[model samples]
Target: MTMSFGRFDLNLLRVFNAVMEERSVLRASQRICVSPTAVSHALARLRELLGDELFIRTSTGMQPTARSLAMAPLIREAWKSLEAAIDPPRFEPYKSNKRFTIAVSDFVTMVMVPDLLAQLRRDAPLVDLVIRPDSWIDLAEQMDLGQIDAAVGVFSEVPARFGSSSLFAYDDVLIASSSRRFGKLSLETFSHLSIAVVSLHGQHEGVVNGFVAERGLMRRSEMFDRAAFERTFTGSKRSPRVALSLPHFLALPSLLEGTDLTAIVPRPLAKLLVRSHPLSLYELPYQTGLEKVSILWPAWNAGKAPQDWLRAILIRAAEPLSANLFDFVRPARYASPTSQQEVAASA
Candidate 1:
C-alpha cells in the first residue's frame, strides 16, 4: 500500500494569524468578519492539525503557549508570502481608489499635517485619507488586526514585543516669561512657581516627572551642604509644586504669556510660541536631552502591498524633513517577522 499525506486547510492559517495578531478570539472574528463560533471552530481545527493549543486564555486576553510561540513567525512569513502571491499586480497611485486611516498626535499633526496633506493631494489624489486623533489606543495591536493603516506619533505606550523604529527627534524646551527669572532656581522654586506639562493620558509620570523629581531631590540634598557653593546660594525645603496642569501641548503657549508660570514643551512648539507669544525659550536647567519620535507597525506587514506602499509613502513624506531640518533618524526597519522560535527561546 502506498502512503499518502492528507491535504490540510489553508484558510486555517488565516484564522490562526488573526487570533495571534489580535490576541483575542472575539476581536479576531471581527477582523475576519466571521462569527465567533466560526473563528473558534477554525482555531480548533488549527489546534488539532498542529497538535498545539496555540493560545491559552488569560485575564489580559490569550497568551501564546510555548508551542504556539514557536509557530507564530512561520505563520507570519506564510501569510506575507500568500498576500504577495494574491495581491494585484499593479497599483496606480493616482488612479487606484483606496482609503487609508492613520493615527497621529496633535503635536505631530501640527508639524507634519501640511506636508502630508499636500503630498496626498499631489500623488494619490483619489485616495481617501482619514486622520484620527491620537488617544490611549493600542496602535500596534490595531495595526496587526488591520484596524489602522499607519500611525505617526510617539509610541511610549507600545509594548516591547512590538517592532518599532525612530522617525525623528525633537527637544523638549523650557518656556517662561523673560523677566520672571528667579536668579538661580532651587527646587524650592518648584514649590513657588507654577509649571505647565503635557501628557496624552493625563497621567504625569514619565520622562518629565522623572527629570523633575531627580532635580528636586538633588536640590534638596544640596541645600544642607556647608560648602562654599551652598553659601553662594540660598535655598529651602519645600514640596514640588505644579500650579496649572494643562493636558494639551497647544494650550501651554497662551497659558505661559505674561504670567510667572513656566511651561516645558517640545522644541518646535516652544519656537512657535516664542515667535507668536511674549515668551522666551530657555534650555531646562536640568539636562533632559532631546526627545526621539518613532513610527511603528506590525512585523507581519513588511511584504504586503498595501502596507509596503503606505510605509514607503510615510518615509518619502518624512525624508525632506530629515535630520538636518527636524533631526530625523532612520528607524530600524524589520524586513522579516521575528520568529516564534526566537520568542520561545527568549522565554
Candidate 2:
C-alpha cells in the first residue's frame, strides 16, 4: 500500500534510522536523545503508516523485517541529502563553535595531539575536540552513524566507502637504556636481550595483524611491527623473548632505565623517548617496512566544509614532524655501515 507524502511524517525516519543503527529501543532512544516511549510511539506510527511490522523484538534485539531492511538504504541516503542541504557550504573556523570527535590510539595522541591542539588554539579557539579510543571494535559503525568525525592510525586497508588521507610514514627502531653498554645490535644480540613491546591487543608472542575482521569491518588493532622482529629470527633456534607487553608508551622511560630490557618502537616515538629519558636509540638490525598513518572519514562527508577544514588543519599540524621522521634518529657509535647509509639517505 502506497501512502501519501503529505500524511507521512518525515521526522519518523530519524527515529527509524536510529533504531536500525542501534538495534535496541533503549539504544535508539539514547542515540536520538528521546525517551524510549517516544521511540516506541514513533515506531508504532511508522509501522501503522507503512502497514508492516517493521521491527520484531527477538532475544538479541530489534530485528528489522524485510520491508524495513529494504527501506533503510533509501532513508539513509535521503537523510544524507537533507543534511548536506542544511549544512553551510563555507566553514569559518575562527568564528564557528564546533566540537569534533576523533578516534586515535594513545601513541598517536602522544606524538601528534600536542601539535594539533596548539594549531587549533591559534586558529579555531572556539573549536573543541573529543578524543575516543581507536581500539573500539565498533568504530566503523560509529563513524558511519556520524558519531565519530575521523580516526587516525596505521590502518591496513580502508573500505571503499570511507575516505582516507596519509598523515605520515614511520619505521621501527630499537631502544635501550643509556646506562647499559651494548655492542653492535646484531640479530643475536637483539634476540638475547629481554624485550618490551607495545601491544594494544595484548598478544604476548606473535605480532598482531594490522587489521582484525569484526562485523564485516577491517578494524585496526595492532601498533608494533612484531612481524619484522619475528622474521629477523626465523631460522635461529633461539627467538626473542618478550619480557613485558604494555598497552601504552608513557612508562617506557622508567621501565627501561638501568635495565637490560630493550623495546622496538616507531622511529617518531623513539626520537621522543630518547630526548626526554636516558635512553639510547639504535637502528633495527633488519628493515622493518614503513607503515603509513592516515586519517579516515566516511566518504559522504568528503566535500563538507567542516570535515575539509579539520583535515586541512591535521595535515598542517603533521607537516613539520613528518618532514623529519627519519632524520632525527642518531645512530649509535657501534652502528653498522647500513645504519649510517640509512641516515645519509634521510639527509
Q: Which candidate ranks first by lDDT, i.e. highest?
A: 2
lDDT of candidate 2 over 318-339, digit per residue (tens): 8876897666355552363223
Which residue pairs clash within candidate 2?
none
The parts of candidate 2 lying over 4 Å away from their true place are 1-7, 17-40, 49-74, 203-210, 325-347
C-alpha positional error of residue 76 in candidate 1 after TM-score superposition, expressed in Å: 4.1
Give lDDT tens digits, candidate 1, residues 1-347. 22223576777888888888788999989988999999999988777767778889999998878777567767767776777788744677789688888877767677666667788789888888788765555444455455676777653455533445666666554567655655444444544556666656454342242221221110011101113212333364553344665445677766766788887667655655566556665544333344556666666665566667777777666654444443322242111121223223432
**TM-score, model 2 to reference:** 0.81
How far off is residue 109 in model 2, in Å? 0.4
RMSD of 2: 5.0
What TM-score does candidate 1 get on C-alpha atoms? 0.60
**Reference-based lDDT, residue 346, model 1:** 35
